[model samples]
Target: MTVAYVAVAVLLSIALVGSGIAKLTRADQVVTSLTGIGVPLGLFPFLATCEFAGAAGLLVGIWWPPLGIAAAIGVVLYFVGAVGAHLRKRDFGGLSAPVVLLLVSAAALVLRLLSR
Candidate 1:
C-alpha cells in the first residue's frame, strides 16, 4: 500500500510540476487552451503557484501523510476546476487532460489515506 501511494505521489508530483512550469512560462499551447477557455492571462501565475505548491506538498507527503492528503485534495479540486472550465466553454477537445489529472489526483487522495 505504501509503495503504491509513493509511486502515484511521485508521478503526480512530476506531472504537476511540469504543468506548473508550462503555465509559468506561458507556453503557447497552454496559453492557447487557457485563453480559448476564457481564462484570463493574468491568472496564470496564481494557477502555476497552486500547481507548484501541490507538487511540493505531495513530495513532502511521502514522509508526512497528512500533508500528502491535503495536497491531494487541493490537486483534485484544481483539476475539478479545470474540467469545469473546459465544460463551461464547450471545449470537449481540451477536456481529456484535466479529466485524467482529476482521476489521478483522486486516486492519490484515496491511496494516501489508505496508506496512512
Candidate 2:
C-alpha cells in the first residue's frame, strides 16, 4: 500500500511538472489559447507562475508534507478548471486529458492520506 502511494506520487509529480513546464515556457501560447476561450490575458502569467511553483513543490516538497499536499491540491483544481475552460470553448482535444490527470493526482493524494 505504501508502494502504491509512492508510485502514484511519482506519476502525479510527472504530470504536474509537465503541465507546469508547458505553461511556464509557453505563456504566450497559453495566453492566446485562453484568449480564444475568453480568458483574460493578464492572468496567464500569474497562473503560469502558480503552476510552476506547484510543480516545483511536488518535486522537492518532502520536507513539508502538508505543503506538498497543498500544492498537489492546487494542481488538481487547476486541471479541473482547465477541463472546464476547454469544454466551454468546445475544445475536445483538451477536455479528457486534464480530467484524467486531475483524477490521478487526487487519487495519489488520497492514497497518501490513507497510508498515513
Candidate 3:
C-alpha cells in the first residue's frame, strides 16, 4: 500500500510540477488555453504557486503523512474548481483532464487517510 501510494503521488507530483512550471513560465500553449477558458491571465502566477506548493507538499509527505494528506486534499479542491470552471463555460471537451486529476487526487487522499 505504501509503495502504491508513493508511486501515485510521484506521478501526480511530476505532472503538477511540470504544469506549475509551464504556468509560471507563461508558456504560449498554457496562456492560449487559459485565454480560451476565459481564465484571468493575472491568476496564472497564483495558480502556479499553488500547484508548486501542492506538489512539494506531496513529495514532502512521503516522510510526513499529514502533509501528504493535506496536499492531496488541496489538489482535489483545486481540480474541483477546475472542473467547475470548465462546466461554467460548457466545455465538456475540457472536462476529462480535470476530472481525471480530481479522481487521482481523491484516491490519493483516501489512501493517505487509510494509511493513518
Candidate 4:
C-alpha cells in the first residue's frame, strides 16, 4: 500500500510539475487557453505557483506523511476550482483533464489518510 501511495504521488507530481512549468514558461499558450475558458490570464501564474508548491509538498511528503496529505488536499481544491471555472464557462470540452487530475488528487488524499 505504501508503494502504491508513493507511485501515485510520484505520477501526480510529474503531471502537476509539468503543468506548472508550462504555465510559467508558456505564457502565450496558457493565456489563450485560459481566455478561451473565460479565466483571467493573470491567474495563470498564481495557479502555476500553487501547482509548484503542491508538487514540492508531495515530493517532500514522501518522507513526511502529513505534508503529502496536505498537498493532496490542496491539489483537490485547486482542481475543484478548475472544474468550476470550466463549468461556468460551459467549456465541457476542457473538463476531462482537470476532472482526471481531481480524481487522482482525491485518491492520493484518501490513500494518504488511510496509510496514516
Clashing pairs in 3: none
| Candidate 3 lDDT tens digits, 1-57 | 677788888999888989899988999978876777899889999999999988898
lDDT of each prediction vs. the true structure? 0.95, 0.70, 0.87, 0.87
- TM per prediction: 0.98, 0.73, 0.93, 0.92
**Model 2: CA > 4 A from native:** 27-33, 40-42, 60-63
RMSD to native for every prediction? Answer: 0.5, 2.7, 1.1, 1.3
Model 4 pairs in collision: none
Candidate 4: stretches off by over 4 Å: 27-29
lDDT of 4 by residue, 1-116 (tens): 67778888999999998898878777676666678987766777898999999988888887899999999999999999999988998888878989999999998888888877
Q: Please name the candidate that would achieve the greatest TM-score relative to the true structure.
A: 1
lDDT of 1 at 82: 99
- Could you give me the TM-score of model 1 versus the true structure? 0.98
Best by lDDT: 1
> Which has the better TM-score: candidate 3, or candidate 4?
3
Ordered from best to worst TM-score, the candidate numbers read: 1, 3, 4, 2
**Which stretches of model 1 miss by more than 4 angstroms?**
none
lDDT of 1 by residue, 3-116 (tens): 998899899999999999999899999999999999998999999999999999988999999999999999999999999999999999999999999999999999999999
Better of 2 and 4 by TM-score: 4
lDDT of 2 at 86: 89
Q: Candidate 3: where is the Cα deviation over 4 Å?
A: none
